[model samples]
Target: MQELPGVGLVERARAVAPLIAREADEIERSRRLTPSVVAVLIENGLYRALLPQSLGGAEAPIETFMQMLEEIAKADASTAWCLGQCSVCAMIAAWLDPDTAQEIFNVAPGILAWGAIAHEARSVEGGYRVTARWDFASGSRQASWLGAHVRIVEADGTPRKNADGSPEVRTILFPVASATLHDVWQAIGLAGTGTDSYEVADLFIPERFTAFRDVPAALREPGPLYRIGTGATFSLGFAAVSLGVARATLDAAIALARAKHPSLAGTAMRDNQAVQGLIGRTEGDLRAAGAYLYATAHTMWRDLCATGEFSAAHRSAVRLAATWTIHQSAKVVDAAYHMAGATAVFRSQPFERRFRDMHAIAQQIQARDTHYEDVGKAILAGG
Candidate 1:
């Protein structure tokens, strides 16, 4: 197992940010990360941050993962988005059998990407059979393996139930070659992710290749990092990515203000009291959002490490912090974009791409307003 070559994960991500930044336009134009960018990511071990150390992965703390994504997003949000998607997907290895996990993640360019739950897997002899299509697979373009989350049913088509009476859902993994990919990721922003849809008809997955992901009872690894659910980890990572985009956009605005003189204005934009105040206020907002997110993640991580358990309160706090940070980051980006005036609308300017990418991040399921409602309900219930 080759070790990550750098001072740390966050530093490594920051060091590679410029390389990805140079490739940003090409990445967006091609609607996928350039081969060079992908190679850099793999070589740096950024894709293996969340995998178990037992498998030669960094297995860094959630806070480290969040910070890493933020740094990457400072250069390119699409790259950050893809990295976060695939990194969190690696958590499935904790629930898989040791040999199976080794086979899937311990190989060269070991990358796994999966989509949302969209179908059912029928229980059969020794395993299950599934014929379903899943969408929004963000990093499929670079994944060697693909996965689908589906509810399980018996051979007679009867839905399998957990101890709590809810339907059982299993994530079935298979080589990417076994599925058919569709080119359907065209969008206003984050176009480089290649978040296409995929389908597999009448495919049989062996029992060894399926796992009860995100379920506490099924974890085969005893690491504190895997204690937090995959969904929450994703929320944290993407929220950090949002902050990075917002930070870069605001910095660009600040740079423009320092150099540009408005038409007919007596002085540079930076000399304007209004622009100074806006910059100050937006900076404070962005800082506060980032602080809150990191604080929440740190507190939860400490508690989980000490107690070896994750509570409902921890989940609610993380969801609230992640959602609020994403929304606040969008506001910062919007303010910065408007403050840049005519320069922001031009394709050549840095502001436009980050603006589009920030909005696209907000539009993702993790940023939905319903998350706030869920947090509110949890608080009201004294959870």
Candidate 2:
């Protein structure tokens, strides 16, 4: 791993987020960033940290990615959501062969924004023509590229067959100019994420630009970094998002609690034993969540960098740990909301914003019922 400079990208990201925090409510209502706010994040290089140095990027560690995302999310979930997705897009740029990597990244390093996961892709004479309606393309509104998972289909546009008549899935990359974005991210919470839909009709992607989702641990044709799994990156990065939102929630609750008193009226809210206990509990949960999350994510990534031998089981463990941290964050934020009482409910209160954001975090599939079940099943089967 390259040694980063003092204060680090994570700390710098936090420093830049305070202003955005002030506008989180507006962001939730507006469903997109104001132009000025968007510029602040872009100048800060938040989107390119996951990109490789060859492309004039930070190439920061997974832990740094999380810390940065958490800070961005703390300010505005939608901005962070979109920005985080863009950062992940840079991940694809870092994994391809150098020649292909240069074509997408060298000309405009840290500029590509992508969406989608490997659902399927297949071979063709010139390249790969892909089809899929990738949902949750969080950065589609400001992206220059679109990506999705697609399987090979016949010349007639039907799914192709394998020798055994089975199936295979692959990642497909397409320039944003060739795709269409569907503005359908209308929800009651985190509306600012602008996670609209994108579709590509017979978009042909050059073979050199595509990276298989399941390359071996850190083994790219030209760079070992290409071997890492996309899931690993998402697990670590999303966990940081959870942490950031939780931290913001706590900060807001503390500020509100200090200014107000408990309705039961024995003391100021901050001075109340129950409130203190909840705060104390929330702090504990946040601490454990962060500690476990960073420890597990860093361990796996470090092991991969050191020996290039991290197993699928190890990766699964990181996924479980990251998801669990998010779950813990939700629990703590819920307690913060309860402790803040009525103040937490008002739109003027940051708690109201954080409350919604935290709920959204817990509700995301990665942090919710499905991930929990995956972890549970894995543990039961000794995964």
Candidate 3:
């Protein structure tokens, strides 16, 4: 399928937007993306967008990948959320042993996904015996491999510490089949993400399959993308997804306003000065937020390319921009949903689903108001 591609990654993503949109109902019903939709994503190279070139991935620029995510998200937030999870997990390949990384990511149909929770792993001969039930394992149904972040401990239950006195934590890798998945993703938003819980019982993860996530010194791929760190990449990708969801909801509202007429209004909603003003103002807000996010991301990337290092200031700026973008995006979605009136209350329409999804994105830690405090602290410290 990769060989038949005439258009680039971004073009392919744009072309599949309709298919993704068409699958939203099925995705919502199944609590996971269907096989057909997953096929479209894999065929389009969306899952491999963030992987390094050395590992048979596109190694596309971060901005390009973010745009692709935004495009997918505009069609379906769940699919975009799952794609973001897989793509971000793939970034770990840049830090894994070259041979191990290649074998894991170069499968016939590439797959990678992981949960964010840290489990417990006991240090043992040649590896660690890990045990934990991880929640929010997005894309697990479609993933070939899964990971668990674990804190290393002695067999006697004492925590292992590095020379600097920091608790030793490592991300352990295993096949999806090795873990048990529990159907717990009963959320109002992103219901199709299949973000269920997975458990592994005393599984032995060889040292080679585990690595420190977001550690720049251990990276095997020297691209500037990895240098920006995993956390920042997540902030950027999810922010893009939030923005995309916002744009789609706003567009749906505009379409409804232009066509639907209220009982009291003689003209269509578009003719209503209040509705006109809402659309105009919301459009400006989304655009400005998007611009801020993209500009901040580009600046960070450029700094990485120029100096081979992303300073503390760059990281702080990314956090700030992503948090601001997500909050603003939620506002835009709220405005659009409210303006859509009774039409938005129906489950069949696009506005309702996007309204739930945008709020869910806002509730995530990346969008927390405390992120503003973190950035403020960084600035005060002269980052």
Task: Return the top candidate by lDDT.
Answer: 1
Off by over 4 Å in 3: 1-7
Which residues of candidate 1, in runs, are more than 4 Å off?
Answer: 1-7
- The predicted structure with the larger TM-score, 1 or 2, is 1
Per residue, candidate 1 scores C-alpha lDDT tens digits across 1-383 of 66442228898899999999999999999999999999999998999999988788888888889999999999999999999999999999999988998989987678999999889999999999989899999999999999989999999999999999999999999999999999999999999999999999999999999999988888988989888979999999999999999999999999999999999889899999999999999999999999999999999999999999889899999999999999999999999999999889999999999999999999998899999999889878878
Q: Ten-residue segment with the worst summed lDDT in candidate 1? A: 1-10
CA-lDDT, candidates in order: 0.93, 0.71, 0.88
**Candidate whose TM-score is highest:** 1
Candidate 3 per-residue lDDT, tens place, 1-383, comes to 56322237778889999998898999999989988899999887889888887777887778888898899999999999999989999989998988988777888466888888576899888888987898878889899899988899998989999789989888888988898889999998999999888999979888899998887877888888888877888899999999999999999999898889998878888899989998999999999999999999998888888999988888889999999999999999999999988889999887889999998889887898999888888778877
Clash pairs, candidate 1, are none
Q: In model 2, where is the ten-residue run with the lowest total lDDT?
A: 217-226
lDDT of 1 at 296: 97
**Best-to-worst TM-score order:** 1, 3, 2
Model 3 error, position 264 (Å): 2.1
- Expressed as tens digits, the lDDT of each residue in 58-148 for candidate 2 is 7776767777888788787777877777777767765577776666655532355555554445467777766667787776666666677
Query: What's the lDDT of the predicted structure labeled candidate 2?
Result: 0.71
